[model samples]
Target: MVVLPMKEGDFIKIEYDAFVKETDQLMDTTHEEVAKEHDLYNERATYGPMSVVVGSGTLIKGLEEALKDAEVGKEIEVEIPPKDAFGDRDPKLIEVFPMNRILSLPEFRKGDQYPAEGMEIRINNRTGVISRIFAGRVRVDFNNRWAGRTLVYKFKVTELIEDRDDRMRALISSVYPHSEEFSFEFGDEDAVDIILPDIVKLDTNWAMAKFKLISDLRKYMDLRTIRLIEVYMKREEEEEHDHGSEHSHEHDDKAPAEKGSEGEKKGEEPSENKEASTDGEEKADEKKE
Candidate 1:
C-alpha cells in the first residue's frame, strides 16, 4: 500500500506484534483481551496511532526512534535490539531497599506501583513490582520486564487520515459521554441554547487533538448538514488531571479512541488567542449555509 509522511496531526492506523526470538512463537500482543497477567495479550497486537503521539514516549525508545523516520501509511519492518528496545539489564536499576519501606505502606502490594518520581512507566500493562524480602532488604528490579528480549515489529500502516471535526465531536463524546454538549447556531447573531458543562481545562495537546478533529469533519461536509455549533472554552473545574495520568491509571475499561477532536493547539499570548479563536469562529462560519 502507498505510504505518506506521518504529520503531527495525522491519524495513524497500524498494527504491531512481538515475537519470541528463540521459538518465534507469538508470546504477547496488544490486540486481544490481555490477561491481568501477561505482557501482550493477543497473538496479533494492534492499536491506533491515536494512543501514541509520535516522537513522544508512547512506544519503546527504539520503536519511537524508528517511527520517527517512518512515513504515515507506510508499512515498514524494524528490528529493535534488546539494548535499544529495553536495554541490557541495568545493574544499577536493580535495587535492595529496606524491607520496612515495602512492608510499611498499606498500598505497597506485590503488583501495585506508583511513580518512582521521574521514572517512566510503560503504558497498557501493570507495572512489574515483585517484592521479595531477603535478609531485611526488599529486592526490587526497576529494569524493564522485557529488557533482554529482542523484538521484530512489522508496521502495516492502513492510512494516514487527518484529524477532523467529527473526530472532535467524538472526542468530546468520549470525554463527556453522559453530558450533551452539541448545538446548532444560525449565522448572523443567533444564539442557541447550549448546556456547556462546568468547564474542564484542556492542555495544549488535547486542544490540538480537538482542533484537528474539527478540521477533518469540515473536510467531509459532515458539519454542513447541521446549522452551526459555537464551541466555547471554559474552565469547569479548578482541578485538572495530568493527561499523562490518563494513560497510567487503570480505567474501568480502555475507552476506545475515536476519530474526532481536531482544530488547533493551545498556546500562550492573549492577543494571538483572540486571532486564533477568530480563526475557529471563521471555521464555524465557513460551514454556514
Candidate 2:
C-alpha cells in the first residue's frame, strides 16, 4: 500500500483509457505499461502523461478535485459533461478560413487538423479539406475538437514519484523503448544524460519524438532535460582456440603438391611422387592433431 501523502496539485502518473458516452468506450489508448494515457488528446498529437493542475481548467473540475488525496494503486472512474468538458459545439466554432489561405499552408490539407493560433483542435481522423468558404475571415470554427461529446475516463494511479530525476527517466522511456545496454547521468538536476548503444540507430522522427517527450515535461517543473551521452559499445572478444574437438571431419582426397618451381621438370618417378604426397598428408594431419 502506498501511504505517501497526496497534496493538492501534486503530479501523478496514471494510465487511463479515454472513452465516449456512458458504460465505457475508449477512443484513445496510452502506450505506457505503468500508467500514461489521456482521453482529451488524440494519438497523432504529442502523447505523454496528462498533467492536470490539480483544480485548473487543464481538465474538468470533477477530475481536478478527484486527484486530490487519491490513493495510489486504486482505479477511479471520472465522467465529464459537455459543460465541464469541451462544451456543446456552437455553430460559430466552425467558421471557414480563406480557401486560398488554407491551401497555401502545407499542413492545412485533408485528413490533417490544424488549429488557429489560439484555438485548440483534435483531429477526428475524417479526412476533408475546406469544402465551402463564405467570408474573408476564412470562417474557421475554432472549437474543442471533441466539443458536444461526453467522455469517460478510467484511470489507475501507478505512482507519484516526486524525485525529479526519477520522473525524467520514466517520462523518456515511455516514448523510446530501449532493451539493450545503456547508462544515464543527470545534469545539474535539470537534464538526463542518456548513453545509448552506438549500434542502435535512431530514425530522425524517433529522435524528434524523444525531443518532444522532454518538451512536455518542461511544462511541469522545468526540472530535467534529456541529453544523449556517448556510450562505447562493448565488443565481445573471439577466442582463437577451440576447446572441444572430440569429433572431426577430414576427407583425405587431394594430395599435397611437391615443393618445386613451376617450370621444374618431373624428376621424381610417379610412384615416388605418390609416396611423397602420402607422407606430406600424414604430417599435415599430425600437425592438426
Candidate 3:
C-alpha cells in the first residue's frame, strides 16, 4: 500500500516517547504502562495519542519539519537540536532575586517558606525556576528546561483526522493541551458540545483560555454553536447537598412557629368549653327565678 506524506494543516494523531539524547533520560511518553514501568507516572498528566496540526508550529520546529513528509503507521525517530527544540541556553536568562521580593507575590506570600530548589514559580508574569537558595537571596533560571539539550523523539503516526468534529478537536488542542480524553456530542444547528476532563476544568488558566479558544474555534470552524461540558466531582455535588441541608435547617427553625399556632388552637378550644358551661349555668338560674 502506498502512503501519502503528511502535509501542512493536516490533523494527525501520534503516540510518542520523548527522551533527552545526552543522558537518555525519558522526558515524556504517551503510553501509560511505559510511564508506570519507568516510575514516571504523573497523576496530573494525560497519557494517550496526541493530536497536532502539521506545520502549524504546534510542535517544535524540528519535529514539525520531520513529520512534514513522514508516513503514517510507521514509527519514526528524530533528533532535535537545542536551537530547533527549545533554543540554546543563554547566561542572561539567569538572575538573582531577594527572597523578600519573591515572598511578596500572592502565590508565595501565603506560604510558610520560600520554594525549594527546582520549583517553578511565576512572578510578575514571568516564569522561573529556583536554582539555589541563599540566606536572603535566591538564584532563578528563566531558560527552558531543554534549552541546552537535544531531544530524541520516537513516534508513530496513528491516523489522519478528516472529520470536521475531529478536526475541530485537533485544533482545540493547541489551546487546551492534555485534552485528549475529551468527548464530543453533535447537535442541530451545526453545534458541538465538548466534554472536558476534570483536570482541564481545574486549571487556573482555563477561564481565560476558554474564551480565547472559543473565538479562535469560531474563526477556524464553520460551526454555529460550541458549548463546554463540565462534569463535577464530589465537591461540586456536595454544594447541592449543602443547599438541601440549609433548607432543612430553615424548616427546623420554623418549627417553633408551627408549634405556636397549634398552642393557640388548644387555648381557643378551652375558652369555648368555658363559655358553654357559663351559658348552661345562666339558663338554670333563669328557670329557678
Candidate 4:
C-alpha cells in the first residue's frame, strides 16, 4: 500500500509527552500513567490520543511545523526553542502592584489578608500569577508559564482520519471531548444533523463549544448547513417518581378525611381541619406535566 504524505487540513490522532528541557519537568502528556508518574495527573482531564487538524494553529507553532514532517505510528522527538514554543519571557510583562490594590480586587475580597505567592489572579481581563509578595507590594508575572524555556516533545501520529464522517467526528471531539456520546446524521447538500446528548446542554461551556465546533466544521469541512438537535425525553423512573409523589400527597390528604369519617360513624363530632386537600395537588400536577 502506498503511503500518502500528511498535509494541511488532514485530520490525525496524536499521543505526546511534552517536557521543559531545563528542568526535565513533564509539562503535559496524553498518557495517564505518564502523567501520574510525573505527579501531573489531573482528574478532570481526558487522557488519550488527541485529534488535530494539521496547520490549524490550534497547537503551538513548533509542534504544528514538526507534525508536517512526522510519520504515522513512528515516534519522533523534537526540541523547540522559545521562539517556536511559548515565546521568550518579556520583562515588560511583569508588573508590581500595591498590596492594598491587590487586596481590593474582587477575588481577594473574601477576607484574605493578601495574595499568596504562586496564586493566579486576573486583572484588567489578563491572567497572571503572583510571583512575589513583599513589604506592601505584590509582583504579578503575566508571562506564559513555560516562557523562555526549551520544550521537548516525544510524539506519534496514530491514525489519519480520511473518512468524511470520521473526520467530522474528530473535529467535533476536538471541541467537546465527550463527542462519543453525540449522534451524527449526514444528509444531502452538505448538511449534517448532530443530536446532542442531554448532559451537554447543562454544561456552562456548551454554548462556547458549540460555536467553536460550527466554526471549525465550516472552515475545515466546507459544510453549508449544520443542525444541532437536542432531545429532552422524560425517563420512565422520573415519570414514575412524579406519579408516586402525587399519589403520596393524595393518600396523605385522604387519611385525615378518612379519620374524620370514622369519627362521624362513631357519632363523635367531625374534627375541623381547615387545610385544603387540593392545595398541593395543583402544584404536583404542574410538576408532572
Clash number by candidate, in order: 29, 16, 0, 0
Candidate 2 lDDT (Cα, 0 to 1): 0.56
lDDT measured at residue 144 in model 2 versus the true structure, 0 to 100: 58
Task: Give model 4's TM-score versus the native structure.
Answer: 0.77
Candidates by lDDT, descending order? 4, 3, 2, 1
Determine which window of 10 residues in candidate 1 has minimal summed lDDT.
Answer: 256-265
Winner on TM-score (1 vs 4): 4
Winner of 2 and 4 under lDDT: 4
Error of 1 at 193 (Å): 16
The residue-level lDDT of candidate 4 at 186 comes to: 88
Candidates in descending TM-score order:
4, 3, 2, 1
Best by lDDT: 4
State each model's CA lDDT, in order.
Answer: 0.50, 0.56, 0.83, 0.88
Q: lDDT per residue, candidate 4, 1-289, as tens digits?
A: 2143678898998999999999999999999999999999999898999988987776789998888677888888999999999999999999999988888899779985558999999987899999999999999999998999999999988988889988988898888877889999989757999999988988989989999999898889988899999898999999999999999999999999999888777653222232343656777889999
After TM-score superposition, the amount by which residue 55's alpha carbon in candidate 2 deviates from its true location, in angstroms, is 10
lDDT of 2 at 191: 67
Clash count, candidate 2: 16
Per-model TM values vs. the true structure: 0.42, 0.44, 0.66, 0.77
Residues 1-289, candidate 3: write the lDDT tens digits: 2275777667788898989999998888999998888889998777788887776676889888788657778889999999899999999999999988878877777776557899998876789998998998988999997889999999888888889878877777767766567788878756889888887766898887788678766655656799898886678679999999999999999999999999999989999999999999999999999
Clashing pairs in 4: none
